[model samples]
Target: MKVLTETWWSAAIGREKTVTVVLPPSYSPVGGPFPVLYLLHGFGGNRNTWLQCANLSAVVDSHRLVLVLPESGRAWFINDARGRRYEDYLVHEVVDHVDAAFNTVPTRDGRAVGGFSMGGAAALYQALLHGDRFSVVASNGGAFEAPLREGDPYEALRGDRNLAIPSTRDHERVWGPAGSEVRRRYDPYSLIRNRDPRHPIEVYLDIGLDDYPRMISMNRRTRDALTAGSVPHEYRERPGGHDWDFVDAGLRDLFAFTQGHLLSA
Candidate 1:
């Protein structure tokens, strides 16, 4: 297996965004291209989260697929109206650059995206909103619709002065606006509501039964919505909590499922 670290830059962010790309044992530029998985990191994490926190390279190399881990910081993988075009930076800039520079198969079928926590939600949003660009998506313990709920942790980071929780609106401010419509756009629950039931993308989601209570409720609601809409998906709940231990344990199952679908692509 070959691991390339911090090789690409993101022009949209105007800074050096670190990334880790892993190539399978037989990877060769002259021989052929391989399917790619864009792995996103959670809040307070960098590109190395997958490598250091979980053994993704070992898992992917065993299957002979390419994996790319991109750093999005705490931006939640969304383009803020405040001027950060992170969504553009990721789907357009990063995907285009990687396909051109590496022996990566650039097609909806050849691509898959997933993440944990905030990153998981981002992956879901990316796949849902841009279904034509991705064939598979998975979210492990993601804040699927946390952006729409009260007492969001992000509010503590925003430092906004006008919000109801002025002292704790800082994080929300950083994410920009708090209107119902804007919140709905980021909320996965709303995505399922607005989109067609037969959306082509395949989605996988699971959160520990003992994690955040609010998120647990939201995931149930999300499952209900999917069922009501007849949207096909995979959902699982197990004994764990919201932490790296639970995520690392969950990765094997999630990766196995993703590998099967992504390889078929």
Candidate 2:
């Protein structure tokens, strides 16, 4: 596999952004375009998270797919009410820049998106909102439910039983003050409920049984919502937790599902 770290100016955010791209082993300028998969990192994670935590090199090499990891910081991959247009930056600027700079299949049928935790929520929201841009979407240990209460914003960052160290304050910046209309607009549950049934994108949802209780509950609720909407999807619960091990294992299945839809399309 070939790895390239690149930066470009994003008009949406009015700043330069960085991204890491992984090309298949057989990639060549003359090899024609290949399908693309955008793998988003979770809260407090950077573009290198996937390469560091998952066996993505092997997966990309085996599948001959191009992978992209974009830096979203704690933006939650959404256009914040506070004036940050991360969602626009990602969908309009990043995607367009990648297609222009690389040998990628520049169509919805050849593109897929997946992520873990916060990133997973972003992936699903983006796919659902812009079905014309993504053919398949997958989530692992996604925090799908909104923080309805004022105190729930810090719950995940605090970790189970308040064991994990917390550093940044993201909730208000991304989703607006808790329980606000802005927050509800970006909530995955709300988005799913309001999704257009006719423009269904192929969905994959997986969460660890041992993951944080909140995460598991959110994923379950997301699955139930999809079922109620009669949206076709693959949902699974396995023995694991919200960690690299769980993400690595889930990625294998995600890649397989993505390949089936992206390559065959």
Candidate 3:
């Protein structure tokens, strides 16, 4: 696989953004376009997160596909009410820029998105909100449920001064104050409930059973919501935790699913 690190100005956030693109050995800008997979990073992570943690390079090389990993900081991959339009930046600017600069398929049928943790939630939100832009979406150890229900372990973490919740400020800025209508609109449960069942997007969700209690609960709740809505999806609970080990364990299956869908699309 060939890896390219690039930086370019982004009008969406009023600053330059960085991204890492991985191309298969067979890729040639003059030969043909290939399907693209957008791999997102979680809170406190950057564009190289997936490349460094997951064994995705082998997957790309073997499948002869392309991978695009973009840095969005802790933006939650959402358009914040505080003036940062990260969702727009990702769906429009980054997608357009990658397609323009490389031999990408340049259509929803040729695209897939997946991530873990904060990025996992963002991947689901993006696919649900913009089904026309992706053929498949996967989330591993995703933070799907919102509003931090009573008894949620995260609630206690929120109040603990000793713990560092990196997403605190960005969550508020992106979704507005907790319990607001804006938050509801971006919640994965709400999005799934409101989505049209006729939309043709394949969904995959998995969470490590030993992950944060709140995260596991939220992922199960998301699966329940999808089941209740009759949204076609694949859900799994594996014996692991919220770390690279779990993600690496599932990367092969995730990539296989994505590759199957993209090829059939």
Q: Which stretches of model 1 miss by more than 4 angstroms?
A: 6-9, 152-167, 196-199, 263-265
The most accurate candidate by lDDT is: 3
lDDT of 2 at 158: 60
Each candidate structure's TM-score, on Cα atoms with residue i matched to residue i, is 0.86, 0.90, 0.90
**1 or 2, greater by TM-score:** 2
| Ranking according to TM-score, highest score first | 2, 3, 1
Ranked by lDDT from best down, the candidates are 3, 2, 1
Rate residue 135 of model 3 by lDDT. Answer: 72
What C-alpha lDDT values do all the predictions have? 0.73, 0.78, 0.79
Candidate 3's TM-score reads: 0.90
Per-residue lDDT of candidate 2, residues 85-176 (tens digit): 88888788878888888888888888888888878888888888887788788888876664343445455456456232123354655666
User: Which parts of model 3 have CA positions greater than 4 angstroms off?
Assistant: 147-152, 155-170
Q: Report the C-alpha displacement of residue 126, candidate 3, in angstroms.
A: 0.8
Pairs in clash, predicted candidate 3:
none
Clashes of each: 9, 0, 0
